[model samples]
Target: MKTKFNYLIILLACLFFMACNQESKQLKQSQLPQNIDWEYQMAYQRGIEAVNWSIPAVSMICMRDANFGLGGSYNTVYWLSAPPTASIEALTANNQTPYASIFLNTKEGPVVLDIPPASDRTAIFGSAVDIWQEPVADIGPAGEDKGKGGKYVFLPPEYGGKEIEGCINVHVNSYQVFVALRCIPLGGASYKEAAEYSKNINAYSATKISNPPEGEYIDMAGKHLPTLPKYDDSYFKYIKELIDTEPLQERDMVMGGMLASIGIVKDKPFQPSEKVKKALKKAITDGYDYLEYMFETPGFSFIKQWDDRQWMAIREPSNDGFVFDEGDYLLIDDRGSLFHWATFFPRYLGKATAYLNAMKDADGNFLKGEKQYKLTVPAEVPARDFWSVIVYSKKTKAWIYSDTGRVGLSSYDKENMKLNDDGSVDIYFSKTAPEGMESNWIPTNGEDFFLLFRFYGPQESYFDKSFELPDVQILK
Candidate 1:
């Protein structure tokens, strides 16, 4: 009878153990999504920066109270000089030559764009950028005009135009549009003259009044050109500000909902709870990992001619749309990935200096301005207009400021680069100019920098990989 009692007690213990196991599993299942929220937030954070990258570069103009607009507190038109410095407002990674720029708030009406005639060497282009910084229309060289400049009337979305129809008509995808003009002084035009002609690029209310006020120019020389906002916790603030000011498109509604779940909503205040912020911090880690992989993938890079070369280019467009049937088939992931990695302006192969920035030397090591290096351009370079090698700060993403006040050696510099016996050119980057190769030498000022190899009006050879540029070979 005692033995029978012992067996009953053992069975009861087994039952209790099984029940506890089941209860633990149920709890884990209930908490799974909450625990995985970190992964969700990372993807969410990247999307915010990728989509609204250009806002800070433009909005800072207003935030600075630049006193720019005609007869008002803000001046929409800002003129930048050739070879943009760190100080130029709204700076980009590959900002070469003089620039005439404006931010259009067409909530009022369509803004008319007027362009001066293009000289042979003056590579003037006006790009109409939406709030997303996507190119709505690129007017000027390599545009519909083929450098024969004309007046372009920019119409806002859902517009029934009430303005004159004599000029070329282009449409803006969003109401909050920013236009930037790049003019490289060519055919012997004076720098001052080129700067003044850029001012001719103007925008004013198209329908509000006949002959809307002419655009006033503010010299952007030596002024701090704002770069796009950083990708971080503060990135959310820029996203909120943009959504608040600009009209949101229908496709973005889904993302807007996701954002609101994290306390980011248009017209509503953003108030993220501590739990959300904690999840987001971890999400940021995962987000950067995802972005880092994109740089390695071939889809994001088009220059895949040589397997061993680290120099790759974002040579093609990632067709992005949220909905597949309506043709946003490629969508946000890859598009956002590229935008975060580089400062991009939408255009074709040969418009503004097409660039390939190298963070690594030829040996696949990080490029250090502390070390001396040599890059050999073998005989023939594939370019229609010109090609050059420029040094830039790896940290600032701006042109590295040097004692010479010169940034890079251009084929058009008239300084005359020394070519090899086989017609190849060797460009050197060092803290000081090499013995006799002063023109070919780009100073790093002992500062760690990267190289931006630009082929303005790139030729077929660049696409075909026939004219291969040698890697940055370490000299010392």
Candidate 2:
């Protein structure tokens, strides 16, 4: 009986030791740090929010800086003499039209933009935005002057200048403003003809309205202009410069406090400590990843224009002004997402044009660069002016460079491209051109890319959902 009791005691001791070991392992897995460093945590969180809020403004500054790098300054016009190519490193720039841009510094006084009336061969389509990238005036056929051209006077904040007769007055809250116009060819005119017509658009100070100085025009054809915002520590410096140069808006006071926490206060030098800098670096890089994640898994529903197709509107249809200003609050993530992949969003949406984006194929897979694909453009596209499809890198959001020197195939190329018996066209995308299909292929250069199908002067069928575009298919 004693021997049996000893064995029982030994078994009980072994069971207790095993139970203790399991409890210790669980405790180690759930261990907490001895203390929390709230400073780094707060800086990291606020820095992410600040980067999200500052992307649009930073993009504007980057464009202006790029122009300066190209030997052009404020009040100077830099226009592309042909369709944008890989040399033009802008975010989501179209390859079907020539672009004209100008940056005006209005700290001293107002700036006057003189737009010429639309001609039979060409017309301007674009908008002017403030330092905050808010549209102060849209100066194209559908803009302030309508089809007729006039002098647009952009008055600074709280300006007391007398209104000029027959002039469209735009009250702006910031001194730095940008004007970008697409010189579109009309009546099947060549892009070169549109480029020549763009020379008629000019800008001068309102002070010299009587005798305008000769405008400086810099043709940016074949020039390299890299204007994409960098996702790095230097981004904070641009924000600092912007704050120091422009007056703060009332709506941004709370955000300003957040900026202050990270050494971006107005009138104060931005020199963060090593600890803060480390936090900032982590915040911005990770924040960019987070933004990309949000794009992949969009919070907002994609507007499926066709029930059976996978093509979606490039942006949310209801987002007017690109500001995401809801009745009471702002849709911050939507605004950030739009600007992350594009620049030069206008004051209005889908009135003059419509853009559709296709990132996935019909079978619901992200576009693979190593694979081949095909898109079919039907005979009757619902566009009064024209339609185009351009491919951009999924990572850089810029043009894909290749030996062919082509980034898109559009309605403009239909005459040369092979068409089906029904008059529909098949455009291919891959690293190489298919046999006898060189004219209709856009090389992706082994990089994953997205498509922007634009319809200029969209017709009733487009808006009324009577027309539909087919989804891109794997070119097996």
* Model 1 misplaced regions, further than 4 Å: 1-75, 81-83, 89-96, 120-123, 160-164, 274-293, 296-298, 318-330, 351-353, 414-418, 432-436, 445-448
Model 1: per-residue lDDT, tens digit, 26-57?
99988776545654565557444434333323
Please give the range of 10 consecutive residues that has the lowest summed lDDT in model 1: 318-327
Instruction: Give the whole-model CA lDDT for all candidates, comma-separated.
Output: 0.63, 0.85
RMSD of 1: 5.3
Highest TM-score: give the candidate number. Answer: 2
lDDT at position 130, candidate 2: 84
Please give me the total number of clashing residue pairs in predicted model 2.
Answer: 0
- What TM-score would candidate 1 get against the native? 0.79
> Residue by residue across 1-476, what tens digits does model 2's lDDT show?
99999999999999999999999998997796646677888899998998888887898999899988989688888988877779888888888888889998889998898899998888888989887666778887889888688999888888897877778988988898889898888887888889887778778889889998888899998889999899997999999998899988777778889999888988988989898999999999988987777656534423566767778775562546565656566677776777777777677777777888888899988887899999999999998888999998999889988877899878878999999999999999899888999999999999998888999989999888889898999986
